[model samples]
Structure formats: C-alpha cells, structure tokens
Target: MRTVFKNFLVLAVMLGTFTSFANEMLEVTPTFNYVTKGNHISVSDAFGEVIYSGEINYSGNLTTLFDFTQLKNGKYDVEVTNGFRIDISTIEVKNNIVFVTDANRKTIFKPVVRNENNSVLISKLALDGEKMDVELFYEGELIYTETIDGEDVLNRVYKLDKTLKGSYTTVIKSNDRVFVKNFRI
Candidate 1:
C-alpha cells in the first residue's frame, strides 16, 4: 500500500507540472481594441515617451495590432484607452522579439475628477478593490495627501480654499498608474 500511494503522488505531481506549462504556452499575444468609439492605443518606452500612437476611427468590435518586432530591445508599455478604463500591457523586447506575460497586465479604472463650484468631486468604480492614493497640490506644493483602501467604490469631495486663488492639481494613483488633472481656482 505504501508503494502504491507513492506512485499515485508522483503521477499527480507530474500532471500538475504539465498543466502549468500548458497554461503558459497558451498565452496569446496582446492585442489592443475595444467595442466603442474613441479607442486610442499608444506604445511608450521605458522613459515614458510615446513611440507609436494610433486611433480606431470606427465604432464596434475591432482590433489594431502594433508590430513590436520593429522596435529595439527594451521594456515598453502598450496602453489602450476608450474614455473609460485603461488597459496596460507591459512587454519586454529582446533581440527584436516582444515577450508578454499575464502577470504584467492590468486594468485601471479612471477616476472622474471635476470641480463643482468651489468643491472638487472625485469618484471611481474600484470593483477590483485596488488601493488608491490621492494628492492635492496648490501652486506646485503638496497640500493634502491620503491613501484610500478596502472599498469597492471610492468617492471623495475636497472643498478648495477660495482665498488662495491659484492653480490646483489633483493626482490619483492606482495599480501603478498615475493620473493628473490641472485646474485653476
């Protein structure tokens, strides 16, 4: 009985290893598109400079592929935005070949930041329970900063000081993505 149990355990381990390898081999090449209007795709280098930009003019289900083989070997980001959530795929190019993994892909829910009268309203649909950091800057100085966590939906209202009339900047960060919005008081 002891020998039989050991044989069964070895077979189980081998099957598990094969399944993991199969999943990795089945990963598809990343494609950029969405079923809507204003679909924009941009590929940026490691230094945050856009190298290639394209737009899908028509509406509905469509896809546009970016040739990664044309780029030099380095790390890059492929971003697709459609006035809503942003999908970011981080790829590494080596020897003129692009390598992508599922672990480096993420989707960021864009927060709605707008000024209503003297108050700034910020709202986001964080269904994935992603943490967010919000910072308020006045005249290029950090005034207020907060870390939001453990919520499916994030909402906040900040009443700007009317007396200090200057430029205001709101920065929201989530899942390694930073969004900045500038306004005047």
Candidate 2:
C-alpha cells in the first residue's frame, strides 16, 4: 500500500507540472469590430510602444474582448505572455477592416465585410498550402459553403449578394483551429 501511494504521488506531481507548462503558452484573440468593448489583451504599436495593457478578468471559460475603437488605421503588434512563454501577433486596421496574424506570420481567420457600390465585399486571409473550410450563414440560414485549397498566402475575396441583409455569420475551419465571426448588414 505504501509503495502504491508513493507512485500515485509522483504521477500527480508530473501531471501538475505538465498542466502548468501548458498554461504558460499564451493564447490571444484580438478584437477587430465594435461588437464588443473592454480590453483583455495587451497591444503595442509598430514602434514597440505599449498602446494598451491590462489584466483580463476571468469569469468562466477563456473569453477576451479587446477594444480597438480608438486606434487609428495602422499596423500594431499584439502580444500575450504567461510566465516565460509569449505569443505575438500583428494586426492591421484599414478603413474599418482589421486583419490579424499569428507568430508564424500565418493569417488567422478574422473576416470583414463592407458595403460598397450596392455590393458587399468579404475578405480574409489564409496560409499558403492550407485547406480552409468556409461556411457563411445569413440570419440563421446557411447561404454559402466551400473548401478552398490555398496557395501562397491567399487573400480571398468574395462579393456577397447585394441584397443580403440581416445578420451574417462566417465560420472558418483550418487545421485544428476554428474561427467564427458575425456581422449585421
């Protein structure tokens, strides 16, 4: 019995160490639209000047809302660090659209839509040589779905239906990551 207890204690300590290490690898989501407010992440401008920094208040699951309303249209570096592990991303705001990328310089799926000339423009970026599954829903009905086999840092643009009104939801599945964005037109 004593030997079994000792082995159990060692196993518990090993599991605890692994959990702590995993928690140190930071995961961040930078907000682009005005749908949500309040900042739960840190951001720095291209010049490495800290623009926003604060601690995120935890409620239940990990969810963060970043306010980018005050920032002018420009490129910024956003970083999230826990202990010694750090993850940095670059974000660009143009017109009213925002683009975000990961540390490996791969664009993360954060699509934006805009109305122009009686048409809706939808744009997003994907990594080279990756297969992306895109599903777009208008209101609660699925309007479009496609699987794109990307080639060389793709900048994908889809001219949505001009008459498309009401709520729009886009879901992108790439590798093991899933990104969802919603907009009202």
Candidate 3:
C-alpha cells in the first residue's frame, strides 16, 4: 500500500512539472511587453527573457529596454519564448515601484510605475544559462517560495505572503558577469 502511494505521489509531481512548463529553461522570442488602460499596468522584457507585465506608473518618466510606451495594463501573459520555460517566482512593490526577481532564472527585475503618462520601466539582471526552453501562464497558476536572509548579502529565492507579494527561486551561474545596476542605495 505504501509503495502504491509513493508511486502516485511521484507521478503527480511529474505531471505538475510538465503542465507548468513546456521546456526546461525560460525562453522568449521576439520579446514583447504590454499595459492595460483602466488598471494602469504594464508588462515588458525586464529580466533575461522575462516579461514585466503589470501597472504603468505615469507620474514620472520611465525607461525599459524594449518599447513599453505602448504598454497597457490588464491580464498580462508572461510567456517563456524560444521554448524556454520561465516562471516569475517573486515580485514586491514599494513606493509605487515594483521590484521583481526570478532567482529561479538567476535574475533580478525592477519595474517602476509611471501612471500619468501611462507607462512603466523595466530593469534586470540574469546569469547562468541552463539552456532550457520556456513557457508562460496566467497569474495564480505558478507556485513560489519565501526564504530567510542572513547578515550579509542574501542569496537564493524566497516568498513573501499576505502583502500582495510574490516570491520564488531559480538556478543560476557563478562565473557569468552581468551587471544590471551598480548604484549604492
């Protein structure tokens, strides 16, 4: 009986992984971003092969790698293109600025809100390339995790609950050097 239960559990887990992503690594082709009208959200290519789809902070000027000025707010679909499987594990918003990081892909993303002009800016960093295909899904369809931090720089993914927060982790490389921002706060 225990053996049977174990097999079922393992099968279930495999199915879950398959259904969640079509490929192993997050992938996107001809990257794109968008924003909705009423809600004021924007999604764009922030991190490596990742999308920054959410609200648009137009109170001030914003900057993103791709063309997000035409971005709108709505149910943004962050798809992993090029057969790369990517899942946004965590996202945090502060002072109208959205800070998102997919440690699952070893990347950090920051999307600032620009409500007045109805737009948003995207910034990010990604290292390590597992060379896996990627996919995308609707919200609440993926699972993320929260992690604890230490005294020094915290490495690894985590989750933040009960605060309109999203958290998770991903695999990355160490030898690769990609600088998103080098400013001191």
Candidate 4:
C-alpha cells in the first residue's frame, strides 16, 4: 500500500509537470470588429453574441467555446476591435478559445504578456474621425483615461496583480455611442 501511494504521488507530480511543459501561449484575435456600427457589436463578436453557445436563451460569452486552445507559441491571427481587452496568460487550450474569466466578473480580457513578469501593458491608437474615452478594468478595479481625437488618441495603462488572476475589460464611449468588450473564460 505504501509503495502504491508513493507511486501515485510520483505520477501526479509527473503529470502536472508534463501538462505545464506542454502548455503553450495563445495569440488571440481579441476583437473581430472594433467598430462595426453600434454598441454591443464588438462585445457580441468577442463573445460570439447569439451564435454558437445559443443566442436567445443563452447570453453566455458565446466565444467561450473558442477558448484559447487553438494556438501554440507561434503567431496566431488576432483581431483588434474597439474595446480590445484580453488577459493573455490564462488561456484554456481547448478546441477553440475559451477565455479564462474572473470568477467574480461577468466579463473577461486576455491581456498579452511581453515578459516573464506576466504584466500585460497594452497600447491604444485611434482611427480617422472618432472620439472615444477608453476605460480599462482589472479584476473589478476601474482605471480610466480619455481620448478625444481618433488621430491624437492617448494611451491608458493598468496592471493586474498576481493574487488576482489578471482578467481585463475595456469600455469605449463616444457621446451616445458606447462599446463594451469583455473576456470569458
């Protein structure tokens, strides 16, 4: 029995290490269409609105099915939309990209990390004639910054602490137009 127990423990540890090693980073298209027409458009695309996971009765982050299991450490095609929020570290490699969402947040963002620090710092640039106030959220904490001109778009910076599993969301507002983008794990 003692030998069996020791073997089981060894197997568990070995399996864990193997899984970790096999784990790869996912480069996702955080946004399919940033500014399609109106509010919730990008959000719909990001979460697959009423398409896969069920449109009417099920309002779940439809893209939840497309969980990040699609890519390895290579370059994966990503789509940057109006409200691009992706916390790149916590990706679940399924058949597709299922964002690893915050337990408390209805929304999720997979922010990409440049270094081992796992700190995802994003840069924002606007387009031709759009005025937007981009707001960033990390694990329920709100950090906001505004951008007036699309050409003169400013950058907003925020960090996700370790204890909180680096989930993010973006809110872009222009007068009566508002776009909300979130991640789903």
Top lDDT hit: 1
lDDT tens digits, residues 119-160, model 1?
889998887898899999999999999999988888999998
Task: Give per-residue CA lDDT, model 2, range 65-155, as digits (tens).
Answer: 5556457899887755443223456778777666664543323444455555534455555444568777878898997888878543434
lDDT of every predicted structure (CA atoms): 0.81, 0.61, 0.32, 0.44
Candidate 1 Cα deviation (angstroms), residue 54: 2.5
How does each model score on TM-score? 0.60, 0.38, 0.17, 0.28
Candidate 2 residue spans exceeding 4 A from truth:
1-124
Off by over 4 Å in 4: 1-125, 148-157
Q: Highest TM-score among the candidates is held by which one?
A: 1
**Which consecutive 10 residues in model 1 have the weakest lDDT in total?**
27-36
Pairs of residues at least 3 apart in sequence or in different chains that clash in candidate 2? none
Query: Would you list the clashing residue pairs of candidate 1?
Result: none
C-alpha RMSD in Å of predicted model 4 compared with the true structure? 18.2
Predicted candidate 4 versus true structure: per-residue lDDT over 9-104, tens digit per residue: 999999999999789676664442122322232122233232212112322333443344544432232322224442122223345444443332
Clashes of each: 0, 0, 47, 28
Give the residue spans of candidate 1 off by over 4 A: 1-37, 43-51, 60-78, 88-106
Better of 1 and 2 by lDDT: 1
